[model samples]
Target: MSFKRVFKQFSGSTLPRFFGSDKEVDEFSQKYQYDPKEKLGEGQFAKVYKAYGKDDGLEYAVKVVDKRSLSNLDREGLKLEIQVLEEVDHPNIVKLHETFEMKGKIILVLELVKGGELFDRIVAKESYSERDAASVIQKVAAALKYCHERKIVHRDLKPENLLLVSETDDTSVKLADFGFAAFCHDELDDGCGTLVYVAPEILRGRKYRTSPDMWSLGVITYILLCGYPPFFDTDQEALSKKIIKGKYKFRQEDWQNISEDAKDFIRGLLKRDPEARMTAEDVLEHPWISNLAAVPDLPLSTMQKELREFLAKERMRKALGAVIAINRLRNTLNAFAFNDVDGDDDGDDDGEEGEEVREEDI
Candidate 1:
């Protein structure tokens, strides 16, 4: 499915502008260099490529957004994302080095993280344990705590957005993707975020703040300890109903060997009431996270097995999506050709999504 976001900009906003004549950087080609390497990733309105600074020679990821393609609200969302990235600096969060405003596009230079996604990395591990899961959550929770202190809420928190710094270092997980993030200064009721990880209050159309993010974190934690998601169904409505009801269970097969502290941690995060859900600060102090020694090192073969199946399905889904994108592009081209032949008015229709986008890629 296509990812969508909406942002309503107001006067007297706190975000800093990346464009305008006052800014020093206006030309992207003069500051950095790239090989036009095969596209690292893509999104609805942008494409990502590997680039390096001209002076420092350090590697970076450059996200190029076509201004002509963005709607008014999309541009506002992009501006907010840039402002939030500029406001925060943490080891576990992806860093935005600088930005450039070209003639028809805006370019954002970001930290180049080569490590794969969180679940993909975990499935490859020879041995996994509660301690390992705790380590991953600890870093994510710490990063969230940093953002929440500034009143920023990351509306989307899923395994795809969590990435390791390098293939060899699994402990150094970084939180990527801020497309749905927003400042939680007032009550929000926008229906955004991926379906499975979405919080109950959002689906119920209730006003909320940062609590939804914690619920997503809880779902990720559950997936990390087990292989599959807590809530699942063939139908979207059915799955959403389960999430709204907070309907989930820790099967004995997945939890028989898992520690009680770990289970308790999940329970704390998955609470139905937003107020009852654990905050990022509370998560940092939980025994499962604070007391690492208490966590077990037992091999999580069940998780690994389930993860393999889950990953396989994910691959298939992506492949199908790519095929669909290609077919749509072909159809659009064919339509243009027909219009050109018939000379039936000037046809100007460009489908929104152009590339196969991944969470960390953007």
Candidate 2:
């Protein structure tokens, strides 16, 4: 029922480090001019909190990692995430505002993604229209392409890791959570990444060049369009087996109505060999996405059925925020149907994303 039982044998491998990296920022880091205002979420060693910047109106999600957890060697992983995040200036990737060592802990001041995780939206709708799904896929593909070109690999790519700023439909996909990520130039000694999203070669402990993220993107695209993942295991061992074999059938109800190009795209991404699978550039250029208008769009419901989506998400976010705040949150999320990530607001080719992450290689 957990990641432990599923990859227990691999536990002696590098898998454990992936999940263990979320260190509590409170341990050694202290916010200057910013105090934790709201607790957003908690991981094994870290807690994401909303903080207000001193002298600035901007709000940031401060990721606090306990210094005690980061051994001399582990500091490199933390450094890897920070350095890579700052260096990768892509619209789809989350923006890193600032990172500094406070006391002994490391504090990562990042963009406060208000809309939360994409999984919430996916689970709420139970499925997505192809057009909408394609848009999300395209944005992610672009980001992955940027990362791949730089020899960076986002080992973890899943709905939960995909943080959002607005939920305005097809416009809100921002790739977030780079904690388990690693560089392509570095040794692939660590089989680090989420279990469900890990590509087959990664699980088998084989050397892979790239395309693991594409496999994850494929899984995300399929789930967005079909309401559930292609694989599931009440037990981790079974899940691993399912992952290695792709042991599931596409139902007539899901696949019949969906486009064949989309299916082919997913199949290409799900290739077992990392070398054989479609690249991020190839995915972005795929007919399913590039030729989106060519495909027949699904019909929209005009009745009370149309209202169901709003009602469902409203119900879901109620417990998470105040009534008025939640309503505003809903509208803002809806606006993400067209949020600008490549906004050259400052006129520099390196946008607010590049500026926000000051310590990047760029």
Candidate 3:
């Protein structure tokens, strides 16, 4: 099926109440002059379209979000994202041009990044080296330093969130998505972020700060130099346990070609103690990142092939998880509707039971 059709069906199935009136949607379309033919991507809460401004004819990625589909926590997360995006100003970060609200939906006008994901670009290359990996990490570190200095913690940092400006522009790695970001002062005791990228401290249910992001960067750097993540597990519980223990290695087969300085850099960032982890500024000053020219060019065909397979499996896993989540949401909504129709007052018990399920699953 076409991406547009698939997204339409997914949105309709997952969020029936979020669909605005035809008149409201028409007004929004007229205001932005968005071409429905130019779909960029779709996510759990929004659909992105490649739009052109009528005033200047400049291209933009317009994200349409359904407020009615969001829970109270989800709404708060959106607000936090907007706040962070508005405050951040860095060359390596995606820009948010403007935002508008109509009916029960919010529209965000974002910078259109022509280049695809960073890892996908690397995998497409015929040859990848430690120097090439250093260049990417340097840019990512700069972006993280910029955000960290501003007291913003990007709670979620993964390869998929890193994008290049264009295929030819290797240096222009832009950090995208602030959906899970929050202020440094915010209490972050809840377990959040992608499973593999989550830090040891977070996995242990400890109150975390910005160091978790550094740990995630370490994981990305590890994959960049090699093909696969340092830690891997099919089961979530087992993965969390592994992460908490900080059990990872630079296997002889992979590390034989990789430099000691590179391994040291990863070690500093992936330290089990958040206090011991290196900051973004420290990463920028690391010898491996500061001196990239001396790094060796190694044949990474094996790594590339492994990365491609890992990414394919990860995509399937996420798709399955999304389907499961949608089904649960549908069941919850149906139960609420039934209760309302039957004039039932057992909502308190149902809500408590739902909370228990979330605690166990999450």
Highest lDDT model number: 1
Residue runs of model 1 more than 4 Å from their true location after superposition: 1-27, 318-362
State in Å the error of residue 301, model 2.
Answer: 10
Best by TM-score: 1
* C-alpha lDDT of all candidate models, in order: 0.76, 0.62, 0.74
Off by over 4 Å in 3: 1-31, 322-362
lDDT of 3 by residue, 1-362 (tens): 11122123432223233334566556556656787788899888899999987778788899989787898667666766887888888889999887665567878888999999988887787877788888889999999999998888897899999999987876579999999898877657655788788886665556776888999999999888777887776666555555555657676676687888988888888776677779999999999999888777666777787777778777888877732222232233333322322233221111111111111122
User: TM-score of every model?
Assistant: 0.82, 0.71, 0.80
Q: How many residue pairs clash in each candidate?
A: 0, 13, 0
Q: Which is superior by TM-score, 1 or 3?
A: 1
Provide the global lDDT of candidate 1 against the true structure: 0.76
Cα deviation of 164, candidate 1, in Å: 0.5
Model 3 RMSD vs true structure:
12.6
